[model samples]
Target chain A: AQTVTQSQPEMSVQEAETVTLSCTYDTSESDYYLFWYKQPPSRQMILVIRQEAYKQQNATENRFSVNFQKAAKSFSLKISDSQLGDAAMYFCASSAYSGAGSYQLTFGKGTKLSVIP
Target chain B: DAGVTQSPTHLIKTRGQQVTLRCSPKSGHDTVSWYQQALGQGPQFIFQYYEEEERQRGNFPDRFSGHQFPNYSSELNVNALLLGDSALYLCASSSHMRLDQETQYFGPGTRLLVL
Candidate 1:
């Protein structure tokens, strides 16, 4: 069974600043995918960024980027130029490649991020 | 593109009652998955439906079941509801062709309260 862990329960960042949220996982599969999702008060989960375990290069989506260390089993999210709209609960998740299982996501508890003005 | 959608924004049921939650997959998506998110907790996978069949399920008991329609819509049915069953139920959809990449879009979950 694969499990994701987000050590920080809460995080805050000043507007226009940068922040990093940490996440780790336990998985025996060599091929997998890692993802970060944001859920605002509207309760809608939105994809932030994703990283493939086989890709040594990190994944970057504009202001949202990921630092994926496969050997350390660590995948972290970095937010640059944070804005008030960036305030939300961030969750880290992992899933194995197709055929391994049902492709269900294993998510972390989540970290509530507060972007201060 | 009308990312996954779930019906009954909120529902309340008493103990031992049964409830059904509905979901419509995003346009062009053929697979639907259900998840349960408790307060202050992450969402847990309940089951996945593809081709109107349950392809994968979590640790949930038989009390939790689901069905997928020909149009790729799905329903989650829970019997003998318990207070512990109160949570936000989310529906996610993705394409089977892209299962390898696995990019699932989630809907605004349906909040279920069992009193």
Candidate 2:
């Protein structure tokens, strides 16, 4: 069984500032994927960024990036130059390929981010 | 292209009643996955469907069942619902043949409220 943990229940950042949401996980699979999804009030789970476990370089998508320390099992999301729209619930998830197409995502409890303008 | 879609955006039900939620995958996507997001918690995987068959499932019980169609669309059915079933039901879609199969796009989700 794979477990993902998000330590911060809630976090706040000022407009134009940066924020980092923490995440950790435990997985026995040799090959896997990690992801960060953002859900706003619209109730849609939007894919923010992703990191392949085999990659040593971190994943960066514009203002969104991830600090993935595979050995430590830590995958944190960083939002740079945060805007009001960045305020949302962020979730870190892991999916291991357990053969025969087992790519189910194990997610953390999520961190509610608030951006103050 | 239209992203993933779900029907009956919101629903209200009572305990013991059964409910079904619908989902349509994104264009070109051939796989669909269901997840349940409880209040203030992350979404938990319920199951995944591909080739009109259930390929993977989470820790959910048998009461939570699903069906996939030839068009890559899907439906989630929960029988003998309890108040604990109240939560946002999200449908995600991906492609099994793609190199980046790890990426799954999600729908707006169907919010179910069980009283």
Candidate 3:
């Protein structure tokens, strides 16, 4: 079974500062996908970033990036220039192929982020 | 374009009752996946439906069931609902034709509260 772990239950960052959320996953599949999702009070799960196991280059999207250490089985998300809008629950997830044309995601408990204005 | 959508944004039920939640996939997407998000926790996968059939499921019990229609929409039916079944149910959709095969986009989710 694929499992993802986020040890941090809560974290806070000053506005305009940066914060990092830690996540680790275990999977036997050599080729899999990692993702970070953000859910606000409104309850929508938004895609934050994505990383492929084969890619050595860390995945980044504007202010959001990931430090993916394949050997360590760690994928942590870093948010630069954190704004109040960044305050939300962040979840780390992994997807592994179950069968032909099918993939299921396993997610961590999540990290609650608060931005101090 | 309209994104993934779920109906009955909020529901209240009691133990031993049954509830059904619905979802409509995003445009051009044929696969739908369901998840259960407990309060203060991440979402757990329930199952996935494609081509009007169940293709994959997670570690949930048989009480949690789902069905996909010919139009690629889906419904999740929970029988004998337990207090633990109360959570935010999310629906995600992805297309096999996409380069990133598992790039699922999620809906706002339906919040179910069991008394």
Candidate 4:
């Protein structure tokens, strides 16, 4: 079974600053996918970014990027030029690439991010 | 285009009761997955439906069941509900053609409170 862990329970960042949310996972599979999701007070879960385990290069989307360290089993999310809209509960998730369990996602508890003006 | 959509934004039920939650997959998507998100916790996968059949399921008990329609819509049914079942139910959808790389789009989720 794969388990994702987000050690940071809460994090805060000033507007226009940068912030990093830590996440680690224990998986025996060599092929898998990692994702970061954001849930605002509106209760909608939105995809922030994703990283493929086989891809050595990290994934970046707009202001959101990921530091994927396969050897360390670590996948952290970095938010640059953070804005008020960035405040939300961030979740780290993992999934297998194939087999019957491919559709299921294992998620971490989540990190509450606060953006201060 | 509209993303995934769930019915009954909120629902209330009692112990030993039954509840059914509905989901409409996003346009062009052929797979629907259901998840349960406890308060202050991440969403836990319940099951996934593809081609009107259950393709995968998580560690949830048999009390949690689901159905998928030809239109790619889905429903989650819980029997003998307990107070522990109170949580937000989320529906996610994605295309099977690119299942490995495609990201699942999520719905606003239905809040179920078992009293």
Candidate 5:
């Protein structure tokens, strides 16, 4: 079984600044994927960015980037030049490479991010 | 393209009653997955349906059942609903059952209130 953990319950960052949300997971599988999802006040879950375990280089999506440390089982999301619109509940998810629709995802508790003006 | 959609944006029901939520997968998508998200918590996988059959399920009880139609639309049925069951129910759809790069696109979700 895979378990994802987000130690930070809440985080805040000033406008134009940057914020990093921490995430860790426990899994025996060597090949997998990690994702960061954002849920705004609208209650819609939006995919932010994704990282493939096979890729040593982190993934970057404009203002969103990730620092994926496979050895440490850590995958953190970094929001650059944070804007007020970035304020939301961020969840970290892990998915193993498998069939049987076992491609299920294990998610962390989430970190509530607040962008300050 | 039309994204995944869920019907009855909000619903209210009394305990011990039954409720059914519906979902339509994204255009060209054949797989539908359901998730439950409680307040202040991340979404938990409920089940996935493909070919009008349940392909995988999470740890939820049997009281929580579902169905998939030939149109790729799905329904989640919860019997003897409890107050604890009140939460946001999300529907996601993916293109295929492939082992790699299978990203699920989610709907806005239906908010269920078990009074």
Candidate 6:
């Protein structure tokens, strides 16, 4: 079974500053996917970004980016210019690349990020 | 296009009771997956339904069962609920397209409180 680990249990960043959340995973499959999801107070889970194991370049979306070190099995999410709206729980997930019915996403414990004004 | 939706938004039940949760997939989607998110924890895969059949399931027990209607809507039923079953239940939907990658849009979860 594949397992994802989030080293940071709780993190806080000042408004307009930058913060990075660490995540690591263990998977024997060569072809897989890594994802970052955010859950706010509303309880809705939103996708932040994703990275393919076969891709060398990291994935970036707006102020959100990922440092994907495939060799080290590390997939960290960096939130730049953090705002109060960025305060939420971040989760890292891993899944296989099977074409159909591959909806199972093994998730990490989660890192609660707080944005301080 | 409406996104995935789930209901009832909140539920409270006692131990040894049965509870039913519903989910409506986004338009044009054929697959729906369910997840359980305990407080202060990440979401865990419960099971997935595609083509009106259970395609895959996670480490959950038989106490958790689900059904998929012909319209692609889904229902998650938990029988003999336990206190540990108290958590946020999420439903997600995704279309079966080759180039679409694996983009699973999620619904605002239903909060289940098992007393």
Candidate 4 lDDT over residue span A32-69, tens digit each: 88999999999999999988888999999999999988
Alpha-carbon runs more than 4 Å astray in model 4 = A98-101, B99-102
Model 6, residue pairs in steric clash:
none
lDDT of 5: 0.91
Which residue pairs of candidate 4 clash? none
Interface RMSD of 4: 2.1
Location of the lowest summed lDDT over 10 successive residues in candidate 1 chain B: B94-103
When 1 and 3 are scored with DockQ, the better candidate is: 3
Clashing pairs in 5: none
lDDT of 1 by residue, B1-115 (tens): 6778899999999999999999999988888989999999999999999989999889899999999999999999999999999999999998877644387899999999999
Give the poorly placed runs of model 6, Cα more than 4 Å off: A98-100
What's the residue-level lDDT of B77 in candidate 2?
A: 100
* Model 2: CA > 4 A from native: none
Could you give the DockQ of candidate 1? 0.71
Give candidate 1's total backbone clashes: 0
Off by over 4 Å in 1: A98-101, B99-101
| lDDT, residue A71, model 2 | 90
Candidate 6 total steric clashes: 0
Q: Write the per-residue lDDT of candidate 2 for residues B17-84, one digit (tens) a residue.
A: 99999999999999999999999889999999999999988889999999999999999999999999
Task: Pick the winner on TM-score between candidates 1 and 4.
Answer: 1
lDDT of 3 by residue, B12-96 (tens): 9999999999999999999999999998888999999999999998889999999999999999999999999999999999988
Predictions in order: chain A TM-score: 0.96, 0.97, 0.99, 0.96, 0.96, 0.95
Model 5: native contacts recovered, as a fraction: 0.60
Compared with the true structure, all predictions reach lDDT values of 0.93, 0.93, 0.95, 0.92, 0.91, 0.91
Worst 10 residues of 4 chain B by lDDT: B96-105
In candidate 2, how many Å is residue B92 off? 0.4
